[model samples]
Target: MADDTGHTTPTRRELTGRIGVGLVMGLCGVLFVSTARISGGESIRDESGSVAEVLRERGRTISDLTDAAASKRTRIEELTQGTSSSEDRSQLVADAVGLSAVSGPGVRITLSDAPTSALGSIPGVTPDDLVVHQQDMEAFINALWAGGAEAMMLQDQRVINGSAFRCAGNTLLLEGRVYSPPFVITAIGDPDAMIASLDSAPSVKVYREWVEYVGLGERSEPLDEVTLPAFEGSLTVDVARTG
Candidate 1:
């Protein structure tokens, strides 16, 4: 080593001593850094914990968290499936019970009372024979149902499982509402099938006979699309029998 002014130089022993001190200081620094890194919290070990013990604790915590996350994910999936299934079932039930509107290819039937002028046109004919009756509507309803009708409507209301038709004079009484002829019955299904059922039903045949004999007004037409409203009346069916 030379002095700052280049006027003095270090002896060989002095140079050797300086080199040893530098080596010792470098070793000490290296040792200090290594010890601090081994005990650092981010390196999986603190001052009080060994390397193996720290690694084991961290592995267990990671496994537990992973298991907990997997369990919650499974429960969430189950809940999602259950909710969708319930909604699908509810929709099916509503459609089956006529509590939901339906639209599709169908048939429409109109039944009206005969004109007053036709009252005496047929022999042995009475006033009842000139007008549509509850039985007439019931027969048609039954025929439509037998024809695989998905939904049916009478007048402006939907026909459900417990639909009851009653007549007052020449007007139709249904579900606490009054309707005058011509009464309309609409069914949503295969038009060809429903028409076949209407043609084969005995009761419908009887009504057709009346149509031919007394001019009782009856007309059937196929519709490209027919819509039926949901039933909005009471769902009760009161029955009485002999005790």
Candidate 2:
């Protein structure tokens, strides 16, 4: 196609095609630049790295929380030490946190595992049913707490906010030490109230039923006077103060 200067001019179809291709290329370049700028020069991450990134973030969060807890504990201890009358504060700590000996009227509840031959003798008894479980002990302790117990002892150790026991077969692991059956829990409180709480707990009811069926040992007796020793283990906690 010729113009005034006698040059071969491009047809309308060719001109239109050229403009369309130029526009498409320009739009593509704009999008690529915009994405790069938004991403701050980082490559787009795939799903493979997503989980690792999340885990790292969680670890950092947990570390921060642990640091905060330790800081608060230190602050609390500092404040506690700053108070006047050190002897009175010490007595309060001893009395409230089970750090001192307690003597009062309470009840003694003992739990023991069933006999080896009794497992097969019972109709629906399994190996687990023939032994005292940690939960059973937990139920008894919780019942005593609910019954207005002032002081408690699990075995020879004072039961505090930090006491924990786990069942390993027919024995119990309590705060790094292990002991066999016939676990004793003595609580200084009203014996009648404690007995009523024990009888009313659903878990205790179930345990009693198992005792009847599988011959698991359980005994409860009121004591006219009982004395509980102070906790002997190392304690770095401030349970009573915080509470």
Candidate 3:
């Protein structure tokens, strides 16, 4: 395009079209870079990607497993319907499967980590000092059982013969489920004896000292009635080797 009488100049329409194409190219370049970063995992995740997402996925998996286990148990019950001494067999199977829910006078004990500020205020106390460990939970459960708890529950699930308690950071993982503080353990037994047992274990003693020094939380209450839900996860022996 030519300006009147002399120098050639681009028309306004030509200039605008070139600028628009340039902008589009610039945007495309940016999107390309962004996509490369995402493909490289730099933009999408950190070293430990989405712990919350992993936990939610685990929760969904556990739910599905529980439902499948329940269906299998129902099938087993149907198959065993007319077996010898059916009533006795059923009772034995139910108890063995941790399907029986029990209620009676019990003692409820809760253990919780100290607040961060509380731990910070204490001299020489680390963050670990403020959180309840798996050992602490095991101590209470063992003591309660030794004190004659007919049935016990930890965080609403029945404590079966093979139930395991583990600690993942500050959270409690019990029998394929995760729980956050405060962890509660209820035992249907002589409340006095249960509480006494909890108070007397060596680990429990250490926990109490931390409770005094670091402000960890501990509470025990006797209840006239407390019922624990039946264990819902698979009871199938995952590993079996003939002796």
Candidate 4:
């Protein structure tokens, strides 16, 4: 179609089709970007949620172990009171040990700072080095169990299954309080066997070196009877389901 200037203009149908195509392309681009952003955000949220879940599970496991230990102790006490026969007593004792091995006839280990000469010979004993660390305490407790401990305790705090032995800046954290030297860890087990096992353990022997050189702590007072406290903690396990 020629206009007055002999130039042709676009037909109405062609202009409408061009406009519709442009609108469709713009909509598709917006949708693509929005989908990408949403997918990335969901990925980050999923990762964070997974990490939180793992930590929760770990906490629950620790709690359950503590509760189980406590329950076992209570059951043993009941059994001991209900029967007087030698067989019954023996069975009760066995049950108690099974719940959480208690040590008997064990030795008490007291930790403190060493003499000036001893401290000077090695790395200067700091507050951190003076007291027992959680790992050391755990090693000692584990060794006692291996050596047939009937029960164990650190001072008045019972070393239960849930018992946490942590050292922060020379301060001992047990159950829920800060303890200072001389930090005493008592175990009830065969005195000879416990002592031998402790003396032979690499961890104990290492600590013993600290004792000889830095006087980290000393072990003594082998008693015929030393009772350990029962476990105290929660018992619920929170599990995740996969489908």
Candidate 5:
């Protein structure tokens, strides 16, 4: 408020008014940001719709796809029966079936959300902190894959190249089926390496922190012999792309 000639500054009242305006503006900015963040979070929470109906439709589609894949495989086998490539055909069948069920020494992982009573007693802990999430499962699965697992099963369903797992609220959606905790994962591979990978995974590390502090579920064990069943669901394979 000083002039070029270094005259006296504005009165105290004027400076106080300016400071008040700045504080108000700052508060408004903070409120805007907070409101936006809350709205964005609410949108994500509200967007998922009618889970039961969606799962039912998905199950129907998978059943149809399974039937079609079986028919296609049978026709292919008949056509290639006496061909020189019969061995290749047999190999294809073996790989497909192996993806469905593999019996060998491997590792087993079991994870579940903390009990409701434990969650309630923890200060500063939200409900989200007490539940198993999709990311947690993905991180564990990816770690096993990196450890060179030959095959994997989530619950009783085999994991395929096209397999995708998702969660709505706390329920897991896998291969058109819904599952609740405790979630079990079986992977056929070098148990030592798979366990090591789980120990080193970054997401698993974060999950373990929660496990320690907030009581989320976590357990891994090696199995002498385990067999996973074939994936009974159908997959829609798209081969063509359009621009």
Candidate 6:
């Protein structure tokens, strides 16, 4: 046997150690893969939740805007329906106009005068002093609403909820139409009440003075059968896109 010079192979203890190391390495690899998967899944979930929340908020906002628009449309419809009788229509018109007049049971105020003062001592009125400015017109319209006018029309243009009264230079721009001096603003309301409300407004008083002194275009004409036009404009809300 000695002559065979047999050499012992690796012991069982040594073999066990090699096997253990391999097992530990395998476990570590599995743990790393599991962690990575969990992290990635969580990121995806967060992104999805964020997108859903944003969509919900947008839906809510759109719904609110739609409701408001619908309400306004309904109000307009109620106001525009024709009255049963001409007398009723007249009364309705009277009530509305009452809330919008600048003076008495509805007064027609006219402003006209000589351009220049005569010899003793005076100067000619400038163009600015003669015409009503945008602000003046706006003030008058706003006062009408405060007074109780159900509806209003400037010249032939019907003033609606979305109506914008604007002035460019000395000319008035309303609902895309332009009018020169002596602009007519007609409203349907109580004649006396409308005039009272108008007189109550400080701005109207100031304008009245201007009409008397410098001859700015004056307020006038409380016609019993004055009719205003229906509002003509788009009523849609524009939404912005999200990237």
Writing each residue's lDDT as its tens digit, candidate 5 over 1-243 gives 778899978899999999999999999999888977878846644656686767867778876877787788778768777666776776677676553356899999999998778756888888877899999999999999998898999987888887888988788898767778889999998999999999899999999998988788888999999988766665556576879
Candidate 3: which stretches are off by over 4 Å? 1-48, 75-84, 240-243
Candidate 6 per-residue lDDT, tens place, 1-243, comes to 123468656777989999999999999999878877978746545555653355456546655765576578668658866756864775565454331223223323333332444222335556566567776776677777787776676766556665676655555555444555666677776666677777888988888887667655564566565555444344444566878
Could you tell me how far off, in angstroms, the CA of residue 8 lies in candidate 4 after the best superposition? 87
Q: Against the correct fold, how does model 3 do in TM-score?
A: 0.75
**Over the full model, what C-alpha lDDT does candidate 3 score relative to the true structure?**
0.83
The root-mean-square deviation over C-alpha atoms between each candidate and the true structure, in angstroms, is: 30.7, 12.8, 5.5, 11.0, 13.8, 18.9
lDDT of 4 by residue, 62-140 (tens): 5576667777867877776845687577767555533344545667877665444544566656545655576777677
Tens digits of per-residue lDDT, candidate 1, 1-243, equal: 678898779799989999999999999999888877776725533346764455556546655765575577557647757577786886688788986788899999999988777756657778877999999999999999999898999998788887877777777666655678999999999999999999999999999998988888889999999789776665555776786
- The TM-score measured for candidate 2 stands at 0.62
| Cα lDDT of model 2 by residue, 118-161, tens digit | 76676776898889999999999999999989999988778888
Q: How many backbone collisions does model 4 have?
A: 11
The TM-score of candidate 5 is 0.67
> Which residue pairs collide in model 1, if any?
none
Instruction: Pick out the ten consecutive residues of candidate 3 with the lowest summed lDDT.
Output: 41-50
